[model samples]
Target: MAYISVLKLILSVYCFFTLFILCSTAPELCNFPAIFNFGDSNSDTGGFSAALFSLPPPYGQTFFHMPAGRYSDGRLIIDFIAESLNLPHLQAYLDSLESNFTHGANFATSASTIRLPNRVLPCGSGFSPFYLNVQYGQFHQFKSRADFIRTRGDIFGSLLPREEDYLRALYTFDIGQNDLGEGFFRNKTIKQVYASIPDIINQFTVDVTNIYWVGARSFWIHNTGPVGCLPYILTTFKTAGKDSAGCAKAYNEVAKYFNLKLKEAIGQLRKELPSSAFTYVDVYSVKYSLFTHPKKYGFELPLVACCGYGGKYNYNNEVTCGYTLKMKNGSEIVVGACEKPWKRVNWDGIHYTEAANKFVFNKISTGAFSDPPRPLKQSCFNPS
Candidate 1:
């Protein structure tokens, strides 16, 4: 009898442990029907670079083994987010020749802007002279992108008719960093640009609200990261006493101010679009944490870029990373990468590596940056 009782106790304990493991690992049911992504290089799959005439290496070497037009190695935050939801990486609307939009699409561009066009210039001039021209052009691109979606929606709707029932989807907007980097910071003083953040964010809110009116039911918006910490800023503007370890307080503070206002703007949007779900993903904090606590996140080099000349910028924006190499005495001369690529934080002066993007995606999906009232919960589940 004693032996039988001990056996039963052991069986019960085993069952309990099994149940706990299953519960912890089980996937949650995804509430979203689809995902729509709009942003710059951080989330852009291959839209802008593909559109451009120039081809650069070291662009997609991290993931695709060749340049896929993505700025990172393999996948980005949006790609990971799609995977977490059991969805494929968002397709570029431009690449939708057949209009098969079963999983939604990405309409982001590397150097795109959200503001209205201020002027118009001839095509292939390298830059869109005015904000209005770029805005209208991008809007047209967005419309073209949507046409592709409609085509896919029509086909998918016929096959999976219930998809429309869950038509409510998540849309992530992650742009504006370039506008600051190229436009404001390039010419104006940090003080001047800092003063204009409210205006920029306000206009962004309006643009996002318009997107919401179109078809975005759930939104994930991201604010700018700490620009001062970027390799370009650190190298170009570092004071005599301020080293790479110490970032410019003023620049970081401005980013904080912008983030605060952005949070407020999101709050207002939530109140205005009460029926829709809007979540803000704080990219600033995630990237900053990587720099501040590199060891905690398993990174060793926080400030250095994996590709680029060993200089202030740590990047040659005019040239691609791995694909293009200058030869000296029959030896290739290029930016040196860290010994442990995965352990480094910054891939280039401005971008994160595939691993870093994965880390950021996990945080966003888990509600590390979500606002209250609609925090992220489990995303999948398995009955077995």
Candidate 2:
């Protein structure tokens, strides 16, 4: 009798553990009808490309086998999110009007800032839109158009974003890095630049509110990663020797300061919008974790950029990655993609390679890094 009772208890524990494991890894358990994203180079599907000529070689070589306007060698974090949702790659809002929008649209652009910078040049060259506010306006235009043919036979002749579709879509934001990046370009010390973080966050909260009012009840917000860890930053801020991970000390601290405030603001937003589900992702810590344990994330080099020119970290002001440069000696020098892009973490000194992005997305999907502490698959789960 005692032996039989022990077996029953063991079976019950086994069943519970199996159920927990299934819930943790089953991203398909929850369905997200669509996903809409906004940010800078970190998530831009092709916003910069649509506004300008197509990106040069080595930019999208990893996945697209050609330049698709992404800053990285391949997919961005937003791409991973779309894939997880079982949707086609999100099209850029600026893409051709005929482009498919069944999965939603990407409004991110390279060099975009959450707020306008002291100079607009960094906002993307020519008619290219890169400010978060401008991206929102582009979204407004796309929403107004009823030209999009959904996979299902639903017509959008109604109001922009059609109430039902907007309610079902997942909204994501990955901006604010360019705001801090601009601070560095203007030669502001950490102390001086840190002062602006509050205003930056204030604008972000306001934007979230506006988006919330627009019927977007589900939001996934990514905090800025460790900027000091980027090869470009190390090249510029070489004041102190590299930390144990080959990152700059002061620059990383500034990033941490911004992340702390951002997290607090998200909590406040949760309080203000009780009906909305806001998941704050700790991207900074996740990226840093990969930097510390590169092998675990399938990276052999975390500090050295895969495509760059000159110096220890291979980053320079004149010639960045994926661009061909004309030299004074009458020769064209092309800095292309690395032989093993998947083995490296940083791509072109700023963006991440596809492999690194996949790892980060997988980590976030596990629900371990979220603010409210639910898996990403559950973001769209509606509880009565």
Candidate 3:
């Protein structure tokens, strides 16, 4: 009902379609037009702060040079995707004051769950503006605004995207970790969490279908990464027994099961939408490699939390990675970033460092992490 600026979104979508028509090289994929992403902190651009928490200093100190609510020190996987495509990084939809939508809008937020009924994380709320369903609602609003401008052709002029343009744009989903996280945090075993996989993937499938009905045919859905390797999970769920890699076996097993179900759902969805390109990104193997084979990737301690203060894992689950606490001995303990964040795998116990993000992105774009085997650009461009 209110006036929403969707010019950036429309232009971005339209430009991507133009890219597909223009470029076709295997090495340089300048042929990318735009991407619409829905996910949690892993791909969040700044939705966390725009809608909820304000990430403080050292969060973006590595590359952004300031705290941008990114939950990381630099670019995220989504940022790398945009960089690979030669598109401007997307702006968080809620950060409208000085936001630029030249590329597209990011509807992701920190601790966002795929299904709303699932309990919200202890750090975040459960409902509107954070769930994928809520994000989808916002996207519907975005599409409507784009439709309005294109139909009227009033003030936006040529930047408006035709309806088909919006339909053809790439839609990426990197959510679901928090949904399972809720269960794990509750002390549910991996087998217990497995029972919810079907419902989770089913809800995800419904959301994808909702977008497909609106014309989005290019889908890049990232399966959950290796959550057990996260410092937070390792610390919170550690037992006497440990994996050979020192990572939590239960959490990773949960991730594997979820990914398997997600892949199957995508396979079935492919049959449902024969003309659409639905690629499931295998981020687990890529991310897990950083832990299992840290030396090969130049990481010294892949299991250590890059920013945890005064803890074995560098992650004080009780204290997070920001702010300070007063101790019993009249001493104050503060949480902050690591000195060598670039060389570490995990960031703040939960997310990955920028260096790790780039590594995963590189592997994914190599055409190996994707199903149906093709570079991300080719899959996006050729949805047939």
State the displacement of the C-alpha of residue 258, model 1, in Å, after optimal TM-score superposition. 1.5
Per-residue lDDT over 227-286 for candidate 2, one digit per residue giving the tens place of the 0 to 100 score: 988988888777755678878877888888899999999999989988888899999999
TM-score of each: 0.77, 0.87, 0.87
Question: Candidate 1 at 54: error in angstroms?
Answer: 5.2
**Clash counts for the predictions, in order:** 16, 0, 3
Clash count for candidate 2 is 0
Ranking by lDDT: 2, 3, 1
Model 2 lowest lDDT segment of ten: 120-129
User: Candidate 3 regions off by >4 Å?
Assistant: 1-30, 117-129, 150-164, 329-331, 381-384
* Tens-digit lDDT track of model 1 for 1-384: 999999999999999999999998765545666666777777777666556533365555666777676776567888888887787777765564444455666777666555642332235323323232343344445545555555775553442213342235667778767666654444677778777778878888777776665545667777778776777667656572343455656667777887888889889987887767667778888888887888998987677777667565466554435544566667666544555667776776777788888887777676767675233433211123
Query: Which of the two candidates, 1 or 2, achieves a greater TM-score against the reference?
Result: 2
Model 1 stretches with alpha carbons more than 4 Å out: 1-29, 53-55, 96-99, 117-166, 240-244, 316-320, 323-339, 373-384
Location of the lowest summed lDDT over 10 successive residues in candidate 3: 120-129
- Count residue pairs with overlapping backbones in model 1: 16
Using lDDT as the yardstick, the better of models 1 and 3 is: 3
Order candidates by TM-score, high to low.
2, 3, 1
